[model samples]
Target: MQKTRLSASGAGLLALGLLAGLSAPAFAQEQAMDKLKSMRVSGIDPNLPLIPQTGKNADAIKENLKRVKMPAGFAIDLYAIVPDARHMAVAPSTNMLFVGTRKSSVWAVTNRNSGDAATEVKQFAPSLKFTQPNGVCWTKDGFLIVAEHNRILSFPAAEFFYEGADVAVSEVVPQGKLIPVEDESYNHGARVCRVGKDGMLYVALGQPFNVPPREKLKAFTEQGIGGIIRLDPFTGAKREVYASGIRNSVGIEFNPKNNDLWFTDNQTDGMGDEIPSGEINRATKKGQFFGYPYIQGKTRITEYGYDKDPVPANTTNPEVYTEAHAADLGLTFYTGDKFPAKYRGGIFSAQHGSWNRTTPIGARILFTSLKADGSADKTEVFADGWLDPKTRQYRGRPVDVANLPDGSILVSDDFAGAIYRITYTGI
Candidate 1:
């Protein structure tokens, strides 16, 4: 074929068309940023560092590691240095570890080898401002979904796209609409999401009040605030209220053995440290309700329940009762093949040391074995010592737990802004 030589005017037109084509998405991204800026989204302020400082060096992690205690055959080590690392979702297909935060960004933590600490800690989407994009999950279809306080962003082929450049952003739930944009409150809006075995998205939304007023309860119950909301990942079109009456749940997971939904609910506060206990509940149905403002754990609320509406009849009580002020946050079932036979189907969770109690509590990890009927066998401390026993100071606070393919677990510490890996290596 003969080469066609173009005139200057023709070449100029071609270049202009090419430029417009390439700049389209960039222009859209810029427009989106401008809109968010104009709206003055509450939690997107970059100057605000949620935690004091992040990026802990090996020395600091080693010093803190001395204070962590695990089981007799288990060992813990620093897996990655992630800033403000809150909730983590591991993509086995890409070996990409995604860490969410309660501030402006989400981080991709990469470990070259299985046992080594992460060498590369890169921000996933640097373009759009993530306002408390605290909920992160890996969908079965190999997509990543981040549910934030006011928005939800999805990245397609996230692992591969980050190789050439950052992945293009796809809005899963539009900005300023994940919850009521006008009534947006930072109280308990930070969420933790997971792609259910049914190939749908699950997000836990905390109600944002000590107790929502009676008039607000009906709307909240209907909209799923203080509940688990299900979403269709493909279009974000199928959204439903899965559970209700959970006060402030920051962690949720499905039992690998039975696919039953289990979550950690932070019970009502101001009811004193010992009265209203925190919860580890198992929901067998879609519309299950866990007692919250009306009744905390199994006890009727003495402070607010008296002339108010009574506890809803079909409310589900927690399977295991964690102590009040424990602040149970994140959890994962042991599905890896590395641990002993007894732990194959057990649960491991983090307690993000309490702040409201007179004396400090939590700052430890809890374990619960599963019953044959999918109930709790027993609950005990799996890991502890993050809070100094003598000084009553927090060395580190664990926020969430994610298990690796090899059966080891990664626990995120938002207070220290780092991730710790736990493995079994003893007899």
Candidate 2:
């Protein structure tokens, strides 16, 4: 699959390509470091004023409440506020919400009854740092597990609320290879881990650079570290390679009906705007390669020496192609009764917006109707106006999506440092 063709709006795409070339080399080696500083400053606007020095509002939640757009009869409201929170996970059994941060700590919020604010918040596993905790999931037995850099850590869900705390679980370093770098650069975004229906834990390991080839991609897929991996939940046993060749998949979910895995993978950069559109892929089998360094979409890149074996005519392409650099993250299918009948089994994905593009894209929630076989139909914008398309300024960047028991959806914004609840009020 060669890279998707550049799809930016005419002149804007040209300017963006020039800017990316200028910054690529300077920022390439320091990409992770740059992301860290930017994330700490909320990473919303590159041209805006620097983040404030003092007060809770330094990184306060900026609602831009009026700017939000949704379908008729659908109401969007503030769900909760947590400063510096990035990827978040919910444990419905215990009604607990766990939020990960760039500052190397995880906050657990409990007592989240219906229509009530998260009543209690506490920080556990304070000593863990290095890779930001990007993905989190809870086991059937009430164990709270988190993915931090190259390792996974587990603790009891009870300890999150218990005044007298005892750390019952020990962190287990998986018997897998890290992306051999002194600074762990290949561990970018390390998000999207979940316990599959097969009773095994799955984790996504991202690539190091924007679009690295064999030499630059060594130890990270060249040596096979990127893509998804499965491990035993309790003892960290039965480690197996689930899939490979994914660039950076931040959002993943299992289809409730068939238990098949699906993920949204952000495309590689340097290609023109539309050349390499992001993808939604179904993880059908173990060791099934989805291109990556070989091909972008259905096109083959000759420059990377991948033109030898032409992309097969029958090769599997994305189930759907999202807008280029929309930064798709956090996907879930609507299975609840609150929304319209047409929305049943529809896929909802959070677009975190794009920074490298000349014109801003994403920063909204999109809905896609899936067929009975789980293939995508026409994709539509479920929510929008998170970013001012003309000014290229963002009002928010949604990172994750989850549904409440009452059928409402929760979207988490790493930029605004808040979460928004969307409820359908239509008859």
Candidate 3:
């Protein structure tokens, strides 16, 4: 069946004359083709189908938005219905929003008119099936990079080409190459990525364990299993581990003002619901390690017997601590003009609510005010009411936050399967 599809795809490309100027890669295509279990291509696939944009699920999400709350003069509205939306990338050239999901699909969202919500949402490159493609980010020049469980792919001119089934696509990290095969697991596999000021693509790979076992420490460190790694997106080389000792980081953003890297790390579990707090860390320099198996938010993990092997002398602690088990995921610096002056250059993060606390705590948006030195002065709830106080049930769970060019911000909800636009219209 795979061979048949390849033949047809090749025929389709020939018929459309897309192969006229195609050039071979420095690496052999046959060598990489052997590694891909799914389809491989660098051309268009006209047979791909479009996902329906409107349905009952979208309507239900709209109704749930009625109960959502924000600060004074700020309103939340449904931007688009993107099922299983986990991370987002807003295009620099076209303002198109590409959303990723925990499952197989990546959606391209667009706002056709000014001062309105996104009207179109469709599957991106329907011919390819992505595994846990939860991280999406765009380069300054317009390449859309999607980070999956163990692979990364780049789409050139993604903003303009995404309207069709096939956009020019190529591999950054081929399947079975991002991590060692022995370490791959279903848990903690969602990846998030961002393009830094230096133009390197930084991707976070979460180690798949509640507490990273002591036996795997050496191997994990070498492979960046529990850390963030940066690579040249164009050639996928010049790769190096950027930060280490992070257990699971689903959200990462570079401070636009200083180019400092910030990420939210989910800490150890089963150590009481409130002992180890979730961490928001700042990486001012490369090679900085945040405690994981050795220490979690100042509380050392006695289980690993780190007393014999003391924690690293240069281990950097978290910049801020969030409520234990609150599950802080996506984060971004508020660098938009739509909000009031007080919010300029502040931080906005999404807490995706706890799964197994005695009582749930986080289905809301958090705001952190920064002091002159760029340190966090205070953190407060910017938006809430996603969790029903009376029932303790979640109406929506925000996974990631992205900013629109007009100064409005977008919140993606995997539970509600929608992207919501938050705009501040002062009274």
Question: For every model shown, what is its TM-score relative to the native structure?
Answer: 0.86, 0.79, 0.88
lDDT of 2 by residue, 159-186 (tens): 3432222234445444133334443664
Better of 1 and 3 by TM-score: 3
Write model 3 residue lDDT over 1-427, tens digit each, in one string: 4554458878887866654435333133433333332434435445545445567876877888888878899988888877888899988877578999989999888877755577677788765668899999988888899999989998888888776554567889987899987888999999999999999999999999887778999989988889999999977899999999899999999999998899999867787878688889899888999977788787777676764668888889888899988899999998899899888898899999998788888999999888888777788899998998899999999999988889999999999888899999887
Q: Which order, best to worst by lDDT?
A: 3, 1, 2
Query: What residue runs in model 2 are displaced by over 4 Å at the alpha carbon?
Result: 1-63, 111-113, 158-166, 174-183, 215-224, 307-309, 312-315
Worst 10 residues of 3 by lDDT: 30-39
Q: Which ten residues in a row have the lowest lDDT in candidate 1?
A: 45-54
Q: How far out, in Å, is residue 40 in model 1?
A: 25
Q: Which candidate should be chosen as best, given lDDT against the real structure?
A: 3
TM-score of candidate 2 relative to the true fold = 0.79
Report the Cα lDDT for candidate 2.
0.69
What number of backbone clashes does candidate 1 have, counting pairs of residues 3 or more apart or in separate chains?
Answer: 1
